[model samples]
Target: MVLIGICKYSGGGMQLTKNPNSTDGLLDISYIKDLTLLTILNNIQSLFNGKITSHKLISTYKTSTLKINVLDNNKSYIQADGELIGSGDFLVSILPKAINFIIP
Candidate 1:
């Protein structure tokens, strides 16, 4: 079975939510801004145990929608499913249980 859902497409990379049941009608957005290898290693256990938000440097949110816009011209881009779809500004919305999946 392929569990498909919206993920935060950030400069670092794509990431999945800490929990994947998707019952709250909201998306669990997680990210580590200004991240480094050291921080990841330090919190390696937490990350592996599904407690990434335990780190002070990490930020998490549960929202039905997210909006972001880049003020600088650093050639940033928004990607989906491994491809760059747009750049500069982007909006993400969740449809709750609307997205059906085949658990094969």
Candidate 2:
């Protein structure tokens, strides 16, 4: 599974999203300053060991916009915020502070 996260909780309580050194929030305006991309391999052994083999592809990248292309012929479903959006290639970008948040 591939996951792009802005801050903690992006993975819904998954240990992969937890960072003790950083503050937990949706955006962590100060803590997590960049978007993180996590790419997981299909190998069960490597995943359990939490190790990165040099032979494998780069697993992470930091960027504002992410472009995904499905090279495989099989149809792949895409989901956003727990909702199924569609299938196929997609580009996702983050607009910094696009919406203002108010606390009561």
Candidate 3:
């Protein structure tokens, strides 16, 4: 499934909570903002090292939106839509299951 929004843990690297909207389950993506853009690029690249062919980033104006583009080995792509609300400190609220399909 496509996990959207920011998942926050109580301690260190804990399982993601089901209710990301809750006050306690929020994480800030801005913390990593200080990292170089190249580092971020490499980090994202590592996510689909070999399992997928390519990926496309989607742009959205909505603060509560999580847009994802799924790509396959055939060089085709598909888009998945979801909502994510920022709860301050870079935390966002995303749906539990928003995966659409892999493009091919």
Candidate 4:
């Protein structure tokens, strides 16, 4: 799993997934903890350069399923597919090709 943002509860977040093409049947997780502004910028830059997995602050992983236990009093925001969906805990499981793209 890979994480890029903060979880708030744990102070980390998920940036990318298992596969960009959604064909891998696993979730690529990226998480970074205790990142400074410079490190954040560097992470973004490295992601663009396809070197995100090499950063010291970044942790990457691959899994078919995930379970997260969230704190009751904490409020954490999750951004999925460029939209702010909701807050709090997450239990993410990847289903291969469960979605399709529609463009005009």
Candidate 5:
């Protein structure tokens, strides 16, 4: 199953988009500039325990894309897509230079 845009909720709760390509790859740290990577990861972990499954890291010369696949027993496979937003040191340090996500 391919998850697309964030789900629509009329009341509360956060809406997370399933689409892998919906993101522009912009970290947009402007909102939480002070948040550390550990903090972010911890927060994300707490959101849904056992719900999140695999995370695919795709890197290019100057950009990295994270494809998060959520596991669902009712579904066959999960998929998402993202593109490069900017040049970063992480991308430059990774091997292979160019990367793409492929699920089989």
Candidate 6:
């Protein structure tokens, strides 16, 4: 299976999430202005042993729209924030500054 992680933050390449205490300025939202794509190739051994030797970094995309086309005949599961949203073809779009976060 292929695990693809498309995120707003470029957490220092493969780091994904950034460290709060780090002074690398990775916490800045400048990078979040766009999207970063990472594709990881997973196998049975990699899934069970927690090894990502075959993981591949796809590339960083400047566009806000993403289209995912599943070639499989079977239903493909699509998830967001750990919740299954839908299946099959997915059109992901990013709405910049669309939400107001009231951080306490």
Q: Which candidate number maximizes TM-score?
A: 4
Tens-place lDDT per residue, model 3, 1-104, is 23333433322333222333333333222112133566546655434342111223321122344433434424322222322432212224434345443334
Q: By how many angstroms RMSD does model 4 differ from the true structure?
A: 7.0
Model 1: residue 5 alpha-carbon error in angstroms = 6.2
The better-scoring model by lDDT among 3 and 4 is 4
- Per-residue CA lDDT of candidate 4, range 32-54, in tens? 66767887675665555446556
Which sections of candidate 5 miss by over 4 Å?
Answer: 1-30, 49-81, 86-104
Native-vs-model 2 lDDT? 0.47
Candidate 3 clash pair list = 64-84
Tens digit of lDDT per residue, candidate 5, span 70-96? 354443332323443432222112233
- Candidate 5 vs. true structure, TM-score: 0.21
Q: Encode model 6's per-residue lDDT on 1-104: one tens digit a residue.
A: 22333332222333332222222222211122222333223333432332323234222223355566889838577765657777788776555556544443
- Give the range where candidate 2 is weakest over 10 consecutive residues by summed lDDT: 23-32
lDDT of each: 0.59, 0.47, 0.32, 0.55, 0.30, 0.40
Which digits, one per residue and each the tens of the lDDT, describe model 2 over residues 1-104? 45655543433443222222222223211112222344433443443333332214424445567777878627567777778888888887767667554534
The list of candidate 2 runs beyond 4 A from truth reads 15-58, 73-75, 101-104
Tell me how candidate 5 scores on lDDT: 0.30
The collision pairs in model 2 are none
In angstroms, what RMSD does candidate 5 have relative to the true structure? 15.6
Model 2 lDDT, residue 81, Cα = 78
* Order of models, best TM-score first: 4, 1, 2, 6, 5, 3
What ranges in model 6 sit over 4 Å off? 1-62, 73-75, 101-104
Error of 4 at 78 (Å): 0.7
Residue 11 displacement in candidate 1 (angstroms): 14
Pairwise TM-score winner, candidates 4 and 5 = 4
Error of 3 at 39 (Å): 11
